[model samples]
Target chain A: MIHTEQLTKVYPGTDFAAVDCLDLEVGTGEIFGLLGPNGAGKTTTAGMLTTRVIPTSGRALVGGVDVAAQPALAKQVSGIVSQQNTLDRQLNVWENLYFHGRLFGMGATTSRRIADELLEQFQLEKWAQASVYALSGGMAQRLMVARAIFHRPAVLFLDEPTAGLDPQSRLALWEVLGQLNRDGQTIMLTTHYMEEADRLCHRVAIMDHGKILALDTPAALKRGIGADTIVTVRAAADPEQLAAVLARDVAGVERARVADGAVQLDVSGGQRLVQQIVLAAERAGADILDLSITEPTLETVFITLTGRELRD
Target chain B: MAASDVTGDVTTRAVPARIELQLRPVLTASYSALGALLLRDLVVLWKDKWVFVLRTVIQPFLLCFVFLYVFPKIGQGVGGGGGRRGESSFATVLVPGVVGISIMFQGVQSIALNMAQEFGFTREIEDRVQAPCPIWLVAMAKVLSGAAQGALSAVLVLPIAAVVHAAGVHAHLDLRWWIILTLVPLACIAMAGLGLVLGTSFEPRNIGLMFGFIILPITFLGGTYYGWTTLSPVRIGGFHWLQVLVLINPLMYVNEGMRAAFTSSPHMHLYVIYPVMAAFATTFLAIGLRNFRRRVLA
Candidate 1:
């Protein structure tokens, strides 16, 4: 539904380009996540793809129309939910949705009916007549989502869809997004939340400093790291002794390090190695205060690839 | 799994369908979009109905009552020829000028100032720009809304200016039917165009600078206190340069046209009035539309 080739945007006053040589493709009926930290060019990329920002160079096509050459046509097929609230604070919920529908050339009666259905579906029926200013943060975010979908565009771009919401609100919004994808809307969203990307996105691209570091399914990304488990052993004595023991005994131990009085190890067969390490440590008369076993997570994969935390 | 498969299906179906739809005339669709945008602005404004009404009527009311009625009675004096002569009364001259200035201020304050805020922190205009229409249409919607507010200000100012006075301060509203019908709407459009340009040119942070640098000068030099022709004597040599300088001001024509409609005052020739006002509307609109597009894209 969306494609970009070497898409770059350089602001006038800035020395560096905000979006640098971005090559991306979002398939039809798939929810694609663009994961990045702040100033990582996520919003800039979304703006260029949605035709809100003109590209300095390169090309973008949305729903089969060149965004630079045919912006109005591109706009017709795509909806954008910006990071900031764009809802008219003065207008009621129903009016906001109805107005958006009409802007996309729907008839008044048709738009009104669709707005009513969307308000109910988004669980905003009671607040339909209420002013936007009166709505809670979550309600306003849901209204923004409903407003974006009012035109029934083929593609939707949500920038930080749940940035400031409480945990419960974020979960509710995720459910709404899942429902939208199920009903056949191609969704592209930008977020910094690894858990959100892992749980909701069918595919995610990890980005930093205006470049994509990696792109794959959540499960595929974890598997691609090739580490089955992460084992940590906290020692009452010296951690180096426990680390040396694992380094010698476990054949598939990829790496061993000691930090914060804990012996950390990455191994392929973690459960079997953990048993052998416990027996070996007991024979050496070294006390193990605690032990932890974890499956490889998206955070670990991100840290391995970028050498920096995703939340940073 | 291959990229070719995705591009092939989209090219075979989606491109052709979109092209077929594009071949049809876009005028009706464009108008529908414009109507929707205007309705959206109106609905948003409707929630602040009391504030909207107050904003529309308050300034004109206070100006008319204070300057026309109260000042003249309290001997603060507006400095017209001291007579009950039909054309020389202070109230007679001030009424139409007040109405004209009210329209201009309404356009600037409601449309331009409001647009500055929208383009500022909230960026509420992003929603409007996402509509399936050309970017110029979004700017046009703002101008139209401003013109509507200007018309309301005109209606609200006239009656208050006409009746709030002591004896012998007559406001003989000639109400030239054709001039009233044609010129008022034109005057509203001209003011709105001016507002659009100023709104787009100034950032929200510099709005106070706009009032200080642009609006105050326009209000004073726009022939609000006196007719444009009357400024000929306040000129160098026989050139009437002061009169000519104010000719570039759009509000001058609006006020002069209003005087021709509302009272028995001399005004600039209609030949000069119509074309210059049209020129102002066209120039302001073109520049405003360009600036609005630039700001939105930026």
Candidate 2:
């Protein structure tokens, strides 16, 4: 389990805090996700909890050891898979896991046996003797995960776990993480991939600018958008004004705002919705260039909350 | 501990029982992790033992062959001395110097050069530091392994001194047991510490600058071809600036100590050599460990 109380980090020479007054808790058996775009302080949050980056203020406890105060002990309890392929380049595939086991105080025979088992479980036994350079990107990532968990850490922390992988590899990593969680690993990961969060995390916290705007199960978060459908209208100009006018005047429209150069509306139900939309746009002296309707998703929820796309 | 026993504990320990951390438990863990880290490096070295031996011996071997064997036999030619007597004397200086420089090269090449890549953009040192010990201990592992390699290179290079001269161009080694036992290990530690400082001080991109500016200067002026005692003539205003300047070079102490250990050649007194070498070793390790901590954190 991981818990933090107003954990904060303001990198030196910067006036702004990267992670600000964050109070977070991750339960022992849940897969938690911090969903945000780059610089959202998601990685910084993960860094603080993992004790890689010391927090400027506040406290973080991982597996009941204060990470900032007792990093050595915290490290014993936590496993980390960073975004990069951090597999040791010098070691063969098997030695990578074997040494990790050794670093965690496992006996030589225990380390070797567990390493061999991990290689088999991760489907990397064929390359056990091969240098890490021989692995493809996905295989290398899997090997890193296998090494991280070789110590049977209490909590597993992954930072942007699948930022750069082929679709197959990404899915494969997801499956691997899912299996680990099922085996009772306390999992926490930070990612910008909405689908990854939705599919993999039991609880997802939508984060932006170092603050969580919302947190809930993905299903509950999506349902919290308070509408069944999303209608996006791109106009020639003045989309914000058009959105305000539409929100105030249109029936069944729960919320409307300008997002990604368009007026997006969350509508619960609608008859003659397109006709009403066009009439409202014209009345607001806006020319509609494009109009689209999508079923509400976590993305729609995000844009509704932040008034900007996740990538932006 | 059986694999079967651990297999079941894996499920129960997942939540980690509230992490009641006491220093004794963690200290025990740190010792095992440190031992394991060194073991990993030893295993890597053993895997490449052939290449390692070849790399370690090649430079000193050639230095001795060309200067001690070929030049002495080819008469007073390039690197040959004034005559048999001069070449023979130069052989004494060259042989121990070759051993000293070999120790320096092995330390730098093993720890610093490899560290350039480990801390490079790939940051291959990531998982290593994440071991269940203090970050400084991780660096200590590097220094220890590098020192061992330096000692190994010394051991490997010493045989060349005994065997490699032309018949008359003798090194005149005294084999002082007391000095050899104490000084050789001290020299290894000093050179390995210097390697640590260089490797951590330079970024991967500017490693060429380290070689051009730091390593080259350390090698040439490190008293390999001559003795520190012979540098009295290169003085202006009785300053002995070059001699004083090379004093700042840790390799000077190492080469001088090698002479004290191996030959009757004039060396900087062992009195100055021991404390100064220890100071250099401690200073380099302190700076290098600080730099390493800075690089690893924040």
Candidate 3:
């Protein structure tokens, strides 16, 4: 488990704190996500918790040991897959894992067995003897994860683990993470990928500008958006006119607005609202090009809370 | 999975014994991790065997070949033309100096240059420091492995430097087994400690300046071509200023130690060489470890 009390970090030569008064707790066996865009202080928060970056103020505890006070012990209990590829270029895949295991004080036989299991699990057995320089981005990332957990750490901190992978590799890594979580690892990761956070995290903290705007289960956060469904309609008419028509005619429509050349409506009865919008557009002699109804998503919740898109 | 499944009560013994039990594992882990770190560097060096061979041998070989062989053959041998005895004595002095310089360069190249890359834009030091040991111990690991490489370079360069000479220009090595056994290692470690200081003090981009400003001067004035005792003649008034000034160079101590090890030449006394080399080693390591910890934290 990981806990922090107002953990903070202000890097030198910068006025703004990278992590500000962050009070966070991650329960054992929970897959927690720190969701944010670039420069959102997610990596900095992860750094402090992992004891890589000493906090400017406040405190963090990992596996019941104060990270600042007993950094080596904290490091022993937690594994970190850094945002950047920090794999040893001089080492082959097997050497990287074996050395990590050795560093954690595993016996040679235990280290070898774990390295073999991880290489197989991550589908990197073929490259076990291959130099890290020879690996592709996805393979290297997988190796980083494999090396991190080679010690059977109590807490795992993954800083943007899927940043540069292709879709297939990203999904593969998601399954790997999910399997780890299911096996009872306390996993925490920082990510800007909305879908990754939604699909993978048990609980997510939506972060921006060194502060958490919202934290909850993805489903709860989405449902907390205050609307039953979202109705989006793209038409030949001006989107503002479509919005006006939806607002005027739709009975259960809570809000209507134009965005990205489309009229979007927050409504209670989505099916009925979609039908009403089509009829109104036809009556106004506007050709409807597209229309769809959607449930509120984590993204919509994020936008509702932050007044900006997740990537903004 | 339930939280309790992963968070079962970690067993503890009685108070004093429990503390010992915890400390014991940490100490053993540090020991094993240090060995693994050293092994990793050695394995990489082994893998790049040809590169290692070229780097270890070529510079020393050329220095010996030109100074001991070509110069004598071309009738421009050092210490004036005092005939075969002069060239032979010069060879004796130059051989250990070649060995000394090799160790120094090995230390710097293996540790300082490598550290620059690790700490540069690559950020490779992050992975290294991730080892479950005190951060200072991690830096100590680098110094130890670098010392090993420096010692290896001393061994590798010695034979090539000893025999690659013109006719009648062979180094008259009066090898004291005790000195060779003791002094060479001490000198290697001292130079490697110097490497650690240079590695951590300078940024990667400034490494070129390190060689230009520090390494080159250390090599030239480090008593490589001349014995430290011989510098007594190059005086400012009645004072041996050149000899005193070169005393500040760590490699001077290493070269003096090497001369004591490999020859019967009138070198700086062992009484001075031993303690001074130890002092230099301790001083460099202390500063280097402090700088290392600071850089890693930063």
DockQ of each: 0.36, 0.45, 0.32
User: Which should have the higher DockQ, number 1 or number 2?
Assistant: 2
Which residue pairs does candidate 3 place in steric collision?
none
Give me the candidate number with maximum DockQ.
2
Q: Would you estimate the TM-scores of all the predictions?
A: 0.86, 0.93, 0.88
Sort the candidates on DockQ, descending order.
2, 1, 3
What are the lDDT figures for the candidates, one per model? 0.82, 0.87, 0.84
The DockQ-based CAPRI class assigned to model 2 is acceptable
Each predicted model: what fraction of the native A–B Cα contacts (within 8 Å) does it retain? 0.49, 0.53, 0.41
lDDT of 1 by residue, A1-312 (tens): 789999999999999988899999988778999987888888889999888889999999987888888787777778788878888766778888888888878888999999999999999999988888888888899999999977777788999999899999999999999988877778999999989999999999888888888899999998887778877888776778778887787667776776555776767755477678788778777777889988877776776677566777
Off by over 4 Å in 2: A235-238, A278-289, B1-24, B77-80
Write candidate 3's Cα lDDT for B164-258 as tens digits.
88877778888899998888888878888898899999999999999999999999999999998888889878999998899888889889889
Worst ten in a row by lDDT for model 3 chain A:
A266-275
Worst 10 residues of 2 chain B by lDDT: B15-24
lDDT of 3 by residue, A42-128 (tens): 988988888788999999988788989988777777788887888888888898998788777777898899899899989999999
Off by over 4 Å in 1: A231-266, A271-293, B1-28, B44-50, B86-88, B232-248
Better of 1 and 3 by DockQ: 1
